[model samples]
Target: MLFNASQQWEKCVKQIEERDRLIFVSVYVLIFVAGLILNLIALVVFFFHTKTRSHTTVYMTNLAFADLCLVCTLPVRICYHLGVSLHQRLCEAMGMILLINMYGSIFLLSCTSVDRCVAVCFPMSSRVREVRKKAPFICLGVWIMTVGASLPIYFIKPQLPGYQNQSKCFGSFPVYGTRPVAITSSLTVGFGVPLLAMLVSSWGLLRAIKRSQAAQTDLVDSRKIQRMIAMCLVIFLCCFLPYHLSLLLVYLHQRSIPCSLTSSYNYSLMVACLNAMLDPLAYYFTTETFRKKVDLDALRQMWPMQSQSQSADHHSRGPLNT
Candidate 1:
C-alpha cells in the first residue's frame, strides 16, 4: 500500500513538472518575440520622426533603448531554460546583464513619468527646455547607476543543483542559516527603491493633472495630457507593481520559507515578462505621433487611387470647370 501511494505521488509530481516546463517555454517565446518586435518598431519610429522628438520623446527614446537592452538578454534565459550547457560564470554574467537592463528600464520609465508631470504642471517654464536638454545626461546617469547596482553579482559564483552534469548560472549569495542578505539587498536596491520612486512620481503626475483640469484652462490639451499620463500610470501599475511585490515577498520568503514556495515565486517571475511587450502598446496608443504616423501610412495607401480619380475628373470636365 505504501509503494502504491508513493507511485501515485511520483506520477502527480511528474505531471506538474511537465506543465510548468510547457508554461515556461510558451511564455518565454511569446515575451521574446513580442518584446523584440514592438520595441524595434518603437525605436524606428522615435528615431525617424524628427517632429515627434520632444522632451517626452527623449524620455521615451531612453525607455525604449533600455527595454531593447532587456530584450537582448532574453535569448540567454531562453537557452538556459531549454537545457543548453552553460557555465555557472556565464549564467552569472547573463543574470547581471538582465538585472541591470530591467532596473534601468524601470527607472527610465519613472523619469519619463516625472518629466511629463513637470511639463503638465509648468508648461511655460524655461526649465522644460532644460529638462529636455539634460535628458542625455539623465540617461547616462541611469545607465551608470544600474550598472553600479548590479556589479556585485559578478563576484558571486552561482551553482545549479539538481541538473546532472550541467552548470547553471544563478545569483550566488552567502547563506546564513536560511538567510540570504545579498539577495535581499539586491532586490531592495534594484526593485524596491525604483518601485517606490515610480509610485511617488506617478502619484505626483496624477495630482498635478487633476489640479490643471480643475483650473478650467487649457482644457483640451489638459485632457490629452491626462490621458497620456493615465495610460503610463496604468501600464506601470498593472505590469510592474505585482512583479516587484512578488520579488519582495520572495526575498522575505527565502529567509524563512520552505523550498516548496519556489514554484509560486517562479510563476511571479514569469508574469513579469509581460511588461516588456505591454510597454510598446502603451506608447503607441498614447502618443500622438504614432497616431499621426498611422494616419499618414493609411492615407498614402489611398493617395494613388485618389490622385487618379481626380485626374480623370479634371479630364472629363469642360474648360469651364476650371
Candidate 2:
C-alpha cells in the first residue's frame, strides 16, 4: 500500500493542454467582457446618475468597485492562459490583487446583509443611525484588512522545484506547503464566515417580520431582502464555493495533481468571476432599501410607503388640526 501510494505521489504534474487552455481563455474572456460592462454600468448608475446616498447604496457601490477591480485582474489571467510570457512578479501581483478584491467583494456584501439585519431589527434605534453613519469606515476597514491579509502572497517565492516557467502560475503552488494553508484559510475566513453572516441576517429578517405588527405592509421588504439573500447564496455556491473547494483539493492533493482536478479548479474560478455579473441584483434590491429616509443624494428611494400611506389616511379622514 505504501509503495503504491508513493508511486501515486510521484506521478508527473499535469501540464496545460489545448482543452484546458481553450476553456480557460473562453470562460475568462466572457467573464472579463461581461464583468467589465456590468460593473462599469453599476458604478456609473450608482455614482453619477442617481442621488440619495444612503449606507446601503454605499455598500452596493463599494461592492461594484470591488467587482470591477476583480474584473481588471482577469485580462492578465487570460493573457497567461493564452501563452503570453509574463514575469513571475507580475503573476504574483495578479494573484494577490484577485485574492484581495474577491474578499473585498465578499466582506462588503456581508456588511450589507448585517446592515439590513440591524435596520430591520431596530427600525427606529439611534444605533441604527450610527451604524449607517459608519458605513464608509466599515468599507474602508474591509479593504484594508483584505489587502493586509493578502500581502503575504507577495512574499511567496515564485520558484518551485521542477518548474522552470514561473509564469506558468497554474503549477506554482506546491501541494503540501503554504498554498493549501492559504486555500483553507480563505475557505474559512473568506467564504465560510461571510456565508454564516448572511444566513444569520436572513434569520434576523425573518424574526423581525414575525414580531412586527406591520408584517403585511413589510411583505415587500421581506420579499426583496429574501430575493437578495437567495441571490447571494447562488453567487456563493456557483462562484466562490466550488472554486475554493476545488482549489483546496488541487493544492492539498499529495498525489500527482490530476488534469481533471486542475480543470475543475480553473473552470470553477471562471464561474466565480461571474459574481460580478450577478452583483447588479444586489444593487436593485438595496436601491429601494432605506430610500424612504432622505429625499436626494445617489442611491436609495424606500419600502416604507405603506406606513406613510396609513398615517396619511388616518390624518386625512379623522380631522384637520386647528
Candidate 3:
C-alpha cells in the first residue's frame, strides 16, 4: 500500500510538471506574438493619423510605446525558459526594462482615465484643453516616477534558490530583502495610488455624464467615454488585480506553502502574461480614434476599386448624346 501511494505521488508530480511547462511556453508565445502585432498597429495608427493625434491619443501612444518595450523583453524570457544560461547582467537589463514598461504603462493609463474624466465633466472650462497642452510634460513626469520606482530592482541582487550555477537578477522587495521599505513604498505609490486615482476619476466622470443634459451628439460621446472607462476598469481588474493578489499571497504563504506547489507560482505568472493580450483589445474597443482609423483604412482600400467599377460600367454604355 505504501509503494502504491508513492507511485501515485510520483505520477501527480510528473503531470503537474508537464502541464506547467506547456502553459509557460504557450503564454510566452501568445503574449509575444499578439502584443507585438496589436501594439504595432496602435503605434502606427496613432502616429500617422491626424485625427487621432489628440490629447487622448498622446496618452495612448505612450501606452503603446511602453507595451512595445514590454513585448521586446519577451525573447529574453523565452531564452531563459528554454534553459539557456541567463547572465546576471542580462537579467538585470531585462528586469529594468520590464519594470519600466510595466509601471509606465500603468501610470499612463491612469493619467488617460483622468484626462477623459475631466473632459467629460467640464467641457466648457477649457481647463481640460489646457491640461492636454501640457500632456507631454505630464507624461515625462510619469516616466520619471515609474523609472524611479523601479530603481530598487537595479540595486538589489536576487538569487534563484535550489538552482545550481544559476544567474541572479534584480528582485522584487520581499524576494530580495535588500529594500523592503523601498519595495513597499513603490508598490503603494506606483500601483495602489494610481489605481485609486483611476477608479475615482472614472466614477466621477460617469456620475457627471449621467447628470448632464446632453445633446444627441453629447449623449453619444458620453456613452463612448463611459464604455472606455468600463473597459479600462475591466482591464485593471482582470490583468493587474491577479498579479498583485498573487504577490500578497506569496508573501503571506512563503513559510506555510510547500516547495512542491510550484504549479501555483507558474499559474500566477501565466495570469500576468494574459495582460499583454488583453491590453490591445481594450485599446481597440475603447478608443474611438482607433476604431475610426480602422474604418477609414478599410474604406480607403475599397474606394478605388469601387470608383473604377463605376467608371467601367459608364464607359460600357452607348453614348447618351448619340
Candidate 4:
C-alpha cells in the first residue's frame, strides 16, 4: 500500500506501471539530467564563490543542495523501473533521501520567500537586516526541523495483504489507511504551514511591487524580487500543490484508494519532484552574484556582441544598464 492503495491493486498497479513505464522512464531521466546540471552549477556559484552575505544566498544554497540530493534518487528509481537488481537497504535509503530532500526543498523555498517579503516590507528596518545576518543559523534550524519531520519513513510499507516480498523499494504509508486524523494532522503540519507562509509572504511582496509601480518608485531590487516571487509561486502551485492535494484525497477516501487515483497520486509526486530543476531558476532570480559568477552568461556574450556592434553603427552608444 503505497498510500491508501491496498494490496488488491498490486497486480493492477504493476500492470499500470508496465504500461506507462516508457513515459515514467523518460520523465525521470529528463529530470535527472536537467536537475543535476542546474543544481551543480548553482552549488559552484553559491559555495565556490565569495563568502555568503545575503539571506537569499543561504536559503538558495540549501535549496540547491536539497535539489541535488533529490535528483540523485532518480537513478535508483529508474533502475527499479527497469527491473534491475536492487537491495532492500538501498531501496529504504532511497526512500529516506527522497522524503528528506523533498521536504527540505519545500521549507527552504518558503524561507526564501519569507526573507524577501520581510526585506521589501521593512526596507530600512535594521532589525530585519540583523535577522538576515543570522541566515546560516536560521538555515541550520530549518535542516534540523526537516529531518525531524521525515522521521516517519519507518511507517511506510507495502500495503498488499500477505505481501512479504522484498522486491519493492517503497510501499503505502499506513497513516493513509483507517487513520484520516493522522494523515490530516501530519499533512497540515508538514506541508500546510509552509504553504501558508509562502502565500502570505509572496502576497506581501506582490502588493509592495504594485504600490511601488503606482507611485512610480524605482526600487533597485524590484525586478529581482519579481523574478524570485514568480519562480516560487509557480513551483509551489504547479508542482507541490497537486501532490499534497492528491495525498489529502487518498486519505480522505477512508478506504483503499482506487487504481485511478493511485496512478494520479504517483504522477503528482513526479510533478513535485520537478521543483529540483525549477529551484535553480529561483537562484538566478534571488541572487545577484550568482548571475555574475555563473559561466552560462559567457554564452550570452557571444550572441549580444554582434547586436551591440550593429546598434553602435546606427546610434550613439548610451548607458546600456537598465
Residues 185-242, candidate 3, lDDT per residue (tens digit)? Answer: 5458766988999999989867755654431232235566567678878877676666
Clashing pairs in 4: 1-158, 1-159, 1-172, 2-171, 2-172, 3-172, 7-160
Q: How many clashes show up per model?
A: 0, 7, 0, 7
Best by lDDT: 4
lDDT of each: 0.59, 0.67, 0.62, 0.68
lDDT of 2 by residue, 207-231 (tens): 7654544444532355664565676
Which regions in candidate 4 have their CA more than 4 angstroms from the true location? 1-5, 155-161, 171-182, 213-228, 289-322
lDDT of 1 by residue, 163-253 (tens): 2243434312212112356456545765667667666766765565454323244323445655666676677666666655655564555
- In model 3, how many backbone clashes occur? 0
Candidate order by lDDT, decreasing, is: 4, 2, 3, 1
lDDT of 2: 0.67
Stretches of model 3 off by over 4 angstroms after superposition: 1-19, 158-165, 168-174, 177-179, 215-225, 254-257, 260-265, 289-322
Question: Across residues 14-123, which tens digit of lDDT does each residue of candidate 4 receive?
Answer: 87677878887889999999999999998887778746345677788888899999999999988877777788678777877887899888888888878867765654
Cα deviation of 164, candidate 2, in Å: 7.3
For candidate 2, the 10 contiguous residues with the lowest summed lDDT are: 293-302
- Cα distance off (Å), candidate 2, residue 57: 1.4
Q: Is candidate 1 or candidate 2 better by TM-score?
A: 2
Best by TM-score: 4
- Cα deviation of 236, candidate 3, in Å: 1.0
